[model samples]
Target chain A: METTHRSVVDAQDTFTMAREQALIEAAQAGDKQAYRQLYDRYVGRVHALSYRLTADQGLAEDATQEVFIQLWRKLDNYNAKSKFSTWLHSVTANITVSYMRKQRGWVHRMFNIEGSAAEHHTAEGSAGDVDLEAYIVRLPERARMVFVLHAIEGYRHEEIANMLNMAVGSSKAQFHRAKHLLKEWMGYTDE
Target chain B: MSKFEQQLNQQLHDLAKEKAPQRDLWRGIELGIEHQHDTGTVPQNRHRRLAAVAASVALVVSLSWYGIQQTSVPATDHPTGQALVKALSNQHEQQKQALLVQYTDAPAMTENWEAQLAELDEAASAIKAALKEDPNNGALLRMLQQVHQQQITLIERVHAPQWQQI
Candidate 1:
């Protein structure tokens, strides 16, 4: 019975993939409706990642809007070598980083300035906000970028290092620092 | 890591990756997508119009200038030489006016495009003055013709989406 259920799920997955490929091709051909469908499908994921990385609602919205705009122009660059979601998530991360850099401006980026651990995170009184996500965003700026890209987004430390322009050791250190801070913020006291 | 700490790590991995924003972001994205589609050129049509205009101008400049060179005619001394300069200058004026009219309904790509045009006009005027004195010089005539092309090219180039963004 389990095997039969797996076959059905596999068939459904194939259908979804075929449909998504068609949508992508249509979008590449400049079909706005197809592009709109792609936007609808990916906007939530893009906004989620943007919010986590920037830790500011307003910046997240601006970033989300910019991501889709960029995606529309860049659709022709997307190939089938990777899953569409994977490619898009990578694009979203890169664009959000660029958007954040623009918001921070070149001066801050040159000086490697970042906010404190407690800056820009909302109070936890709001309903339906995930505790872990809230805590992750509260991590210091570089640490949050390193953690979100490495841990949650499944980027290797080396790749994170390249993306963030940090040394490999710095990326690993930031990831560990982010993990330690998250543990403390979550009240995990075990050795 | 302890068992509870391991659970915390697992929880981090288990967090849902999708969270719809409190606002409807698609509208903004859709508007953005539309705006991009407008500014961006379609691949097949990329620069086709500008290329056609430039090629036509080149053909006209080369052929007309060749006719003058064949006679080895001094421009101020020969009617054809003087006429050739007038013809080329008229063509340049027409191309510039055409480009300006084409983009007249649209916003100017830069505030100084007109000022830039005036500067080019000054350059063309100086070239014409030199041509009046050294009318038989092929290089001077060539320079005059090329400057006319430059004015047309500048109008089209700046009006295209290729403007330097702030």
Candidate 2:
């Protein structure tokens, strides 16, 4: 069983490497089909990252497409510099933050210029009542971004600061504020 | 251990895995590249220019197989027109320099006499050449007339000093 599992893992690894190489070559050659194949392979994770940060389905989809378009235009810049996945993750974060800033069509920008803003983010539960997702979608943009990156993506506050161009302390403070807002939104009473 | 944090994290997991836009939207990207190639814009790849050219030609052929043909200007004609325009512009500069050298003592009346004439000539030649292939093209005819009028102005500039000032 162990030997079989090892062979399976090896085969899968080799397949993945070969597939990635082929897609990269095709994308370099200006083959949109190869780019689409690559988009299919990574877009799920990219969407998840986008949706988590933005909490808007439409916005997430738009960001995903925009990200891939950049990937296509900037393929030569990739340089195998870091792992493709990490590079993609960085792109996702950058795109999501920009989308958040541009939400509401240039009016009532979500982030407040005060000390901090608090907001909620939730997952799945009963649909009829004010469930988790509805609450999360209401969070102020910056705090929500920090919370999503910290809790969902498991990034440290310093890393979040670098991605967001904010101070590490500010990122940590925003994470707490986001959690506090979620507490308020969820109506989780303390005894 | 706040309930909000737990719920938010759960919601995030549910949210992250949702469906994204279909992959087919990228179909337009390659089409855009082909359009650019056929329009005779220089390909950007410097290291593998031959490969880029071959790939662009292959793309045009393959895409044509699917009934999406590029406009039927011969490949040679497209590049030659582009090259001719470039060469004529260069020649216009040289003509301006030659006129300056030849007519140095003749004129102070018109500052850009040579440039004006060369531009008119270039424009007229382009329009005349275009109208030969596309006689019924109203746009080409209008352009040709515009070039002819422009050339008349250049003739006036060239003779301005002899007739008016000196």
Candidate 3:
């Protein structure tokens, strides 16, 4: 009975993959409706990724828009060597990082408004619940990025280093720093 | 992983999976796609139009000077030199305009491409002003052609498909 159920699940997975493939091909051919379908399916995951990296609602929205625009422009170059979702995630990561770098210009720093909300919330510890999202966003910029990419996104430290243009040791150290802070925030005691 | 680390990882994984933005982002995404399709090439077209007008004016001025040079001097003195220069300049202008159109919406690899292009334009202008004063100065004319070629080459190299790959 369990094997039979597993086979049914496998069949459903195959069907979903086939549907996505068709949608990708249609979207690549300039079908707006097809592209919209793709966007509807992926926007949540993409936005979530952007939010975690950026730690700001507005920046996430901007990055999400920029990512989709870039995806549409570069869709023709998406060969099917890897899964479409994997390629899409890679593109999202690159664009969101680039967006963050652009937003960190001297003007933003001069105003002392770079990621200020997260810094303020983290400092005040005013979050009512031990919310992981709240804690994740409160992490220092480099540590937050390293933690999200390494812990949440499942990227290797080396890969995170390359993505963020830092040394691998720095990525590992930042991950540890992020882990330490989250533990401290959540009141986790070492046994 | 330790028990504490495992718990942390589990919580993070759940958060990553379950969290969604507060708003429906699809509306924004749809609008963005529509905007890209509707007016993606408008800026490039505008730039090309401006370039064409400028090139036309430059061509008229240069050709008038070429005509004057042709009649005032002996044919064998420069022997199609003015015509050759005019043809090369016209060709360079067209190629530059085509490149401007091709890279109309290409994301610049570097932040200072505009500044660099402006500097090249300034250099070209200075050379052109000198050429206006000494149209028969072969060295000044050669410098102007080189500057123009540099501008096209710089624009093309920065916006090439290979840069996008990098």
Best by lDDT: 1
lDDT of 2 by residue, B4-119 (tens): 55665566666534445533434333333333343242112222433454345434433432232236545443343343334434543454465456655665455675565666
Model 2 chain A worst lDDT window (10 residues): A111-120
DockQ ranking of the models: 1, 3, 2
The digit string of per-residue lDDT tens for model 1 on A17-114 reads: 99999999999998989888887787789889999898877568778877877888888899999999999999999999988886565435555667
Candidate 3's DockQ is 0.16
TM-score of 2: 0.52
lDDT of 3 by residue, A68-121 (tens): 877988999898899888898889999999888865554355556534344344
Q: What's the TM-score of chain A alone for every prediction? A: 0.88, 0.76, 0.88
Q: Alpha-carbon error at A31 in model 2, in Å?
A: 2.4
Q: How much lDDT does each candidate structure score?
A: 0.72, 0.58, 0.71
What residue runs in model 1 are displaced by over 4 Å at the alpha carbon?
A106-113, A119-130, B40-166
Candidate 2 lDDT tens digits, A1-191 = 99999999999998997789778878888777887788778878887788767666655765665566556767777767577777778777876676656443333433334222332244333322445555555677778788778876778999899887899999999888777776655565451
User: Chain B, TM-score, each prediction?
Assistant: 0.57, 0.31, 0.47
State which candidate, 1 or 2, has the greater DockQ: 1
CAPRI docking class of candidate 1: acceptable
What TM-score would each prediction reach against the true structure? 0.61, 0.52, 0.60
Determine which window of 10 residues in candidate 1 chain A has minimal summed lDDT: A121-130
- Interface RMSD for candidate 2 relative to the native interface: 8.9
